[model samples]
Target: MQAIIFANRTGNELAPLEQYYCSALLPVGNKAVIEYTLEDIVTSGITKVKIIISSQAQEIEQLLGDGERWGLDIDYFLSKPEEKTAAVLDRLSLSMTDSIIIVRGDIFRSPCIANFIDFSKQFSNEFVQAKMANQNACMLLLPAALSYLDGIDWPLTHDYDSNSVVTLILHGRCHMIDSFQSYMNANLNLARNDIPSLTPMERSFTSANPEQDFYVGAKTHTGDLSLQNAWGIIGENCRIDPNVVMKNAIIIGNDTLIDKGSTLENCLILPHTYVGEGLEVNNSILCKKLLISLNTEGHIEIDDQALIGPSEHQASTSSTDRNLSTRFFILMLLIASLPFCPLLAFYALIRVMFFKLETKPLIQEMINDNLGRSLVTYSFNVPTRLLSLLPQLFLVVTGQLALFGAPAQIRYATGRNKQRLGVFGPVQLLLDEDAPEEERMLLMLEFDNTHTSTKYLSLLWRSLRIPRLLGAERKKQNMTH
Candidate 1:
């Protein structure tokens, strides 16, 4: 029988992580979440499959192209997140006579589909539901039970043929990952080998202590690991420095670096992150400088590069530490703009007095002080877009905002994202103001990825023209109106 995998979730639950990838593509135990789903579908001996996707469809398609390697033909259908599941299934015209397995591709589940299907063979013509204690993992939809798709919920407690229905408890684990806390717990489950279906890469590196157990990948340096009753999986090309103490459950993703004199316990380190020297990291997901606490569901990013940063930045030209020339450039702008602050404040005062404007002259916003390293809040939000933002040049001076990188400018937003605001983004300086959002984003990435001294000065010169540009644009708008 054919299977339909629902991978189209918006996955607002995964946040921050969702910013980079769709939930199905997120890395878990060193494998994409959907990869395990594919393994289960292929292992269950189902060939023809359909995946429903919406946002980031291109990345998902690039990852699971045609599903040829698994000896299966795969087709993708687009669906809005809010659309009813029954409507999408009804549109598929799946068959009235045959049974099909329906699974959520974005979540992680244990007790492989093959085992679940084997145990579920007892009932021939009824709705079969598989679940752990509180969550539903998946379901087998028989023709007789297909009619109740829209109204069904777990407990199979009501409105079904009581005698014909079947509920099988595989006594396995299911991680719906409906929240970040659940997502962190899923990794803990993997570390503990609680999910039998997932085989986290080969356990290669043997620890120094007999009590220490580690599953390490290729080219990893575990020479200095001092573990006391600790066990975990670490990915490829990692560096675990000397005098480092690791304990309990840990999952370090590929291309990570755990520095000297640091203590890590019960933490999941995402790939390309650098844990600082001599710091204690525990019970959290550490990515770059960002630390997300699993216990409290709170997150903090440390800006001190010697403490925490991106792995690549630790070894190379760091965006966190600004160069002397860039600092000088920011100083020059700050000196230029400091004079205008009082005038802008007076304007704001007048607007408040006569125009009944309720907004404060300046509003507080939090931003990454050094790229994405540390978070700092500043007063940069003003009602006026261009001239009023002169007061915000101090953020660039303070290294909280970039002069020539990423058009994240509260200084240049053509959109409405007041959250985590900053100023003096050079997006409009590098690309046409009317350029498509995708093009603007690409340009910003270029600025972000490669901010050479020569390039920085070129963009700085271009920024000088913003006043005339803003004036001309304002005239054009007035004429149009």
Candidate 2:
């Protein structure tokens, strides 16, 4: 039977991981993640497969070109995300009469296809899905013919029996790793499960030195080194350095070097990178272009494109504690004085009658509990008019304080030491591994705002809730992160 798999790689739902690696190239076992799923389909006697890809189609094409290796007739379809699923089925329906199976490329499944095929044979014009509930994987059959004009959403409440038609196979535990910690955790789990012990392509990619437990991709090279389960997918025409010790790792695409005495453990090194001598990378993922340290969660999504280019060429060399200098102190006095002109008259008029006014201290304790010190501190008996203005001036002068940052920090907040200056306001709370991306971007942008007036002004406008152009941009960035 022919299966038209709708393999769109644009998985925005997975977040930042989608920003870096495509689903097809995400390393799992001794091969890319999608390879395992494809093998299962081919083994189930589905000979003809059509793959749909958006960005990284070539990588899949290179691996499964003409599909002779797997004895399946394979073809590829490339299109924008919006034009993907429907477009492939529309083109396929014109020629093929056999049943089709549509599956997202990123999902990993096995030992469940036999049931799927049995279920699909029951319906002549139905869609079958490999559904997993808890540890049980079953095939769900649905009687829905191919109609590109109207997309159908399978009703969740539709009753089903062993013989009744059902819909897609949805896994109860299938999750896409979208962050650094999650990615790391997945690799760690796989490593703990002895994924590395699996043999590399026996006849295809192998090193001349024949060190044990080393993984090298097709037409790739690994120099003399004693390695164990070090996953390296060296593309065609790629070279490796000798004397490199890599363990529990993955390398993708092309052109990289592991300089002598470099040890990479439980990491992902992407293409076009050169690791210097005596480097130790553990539980990290490098895009050859960018380096990322994954947290305990096992997902790493480093913004590699931003790490490149002339605009942001340098790495984050500044210390985490580093922030805008005290040099911006001069701007403080000027800002604090601006609102004083009209405030003076208002204060005098109020002082004429109400003498019992016990003014509150303008300099409240900072979110971090740094006492007496503030971006700007005000004493008791400060004019009512000046009270409101002082806080705004304080935000402007400090340059570190944002007009609106995180929810205000509470007393004795732990991890406050990690706080950095932000464009809009100070993040009262400490950053955790699972901290949201908006918080990270805010901290990163703030730390980079070093005495640059242009950046400061831009941040100030962002804090002010500027209309249209800037506001829309802030919202978009917030939603994306």
TM-score, per-candidate, Cα-based: 0.61, 0.45
Candidate 1, residue 399: CA error in Å?
A: 20
C-alpha lDDT score of every prediction, in listed order: 0.67, 0.48
Residue-by-residue lDDT tens digits, candidate 2, 104-128: 5554444345457676677556544
Q: Write the per-residue lDDT of candidate 1 for residues 51-118, one digit (tens) a residue.
A: 87776665676677789988889999988763456788878887778766667788877746776667
Candidate 2 local lDDT, residue 280: 74
Superposed model 2: Cα runs more than 4 Å off? 11-20, 82-97, 122-129, 133-256, 296-481
Clashing residue pairs in candidate 1 (N, C-alpha, C atoms within 3 angstroms): none
Q: Which residues of candidate 1, in runs, are more than 4 Å off?
A: 118-122, 150-164, 208-212, 226-229, 303-306, 315-481
Q: How far is 131's C-alpha from truth in model 1 (Å)?
A: 1.7
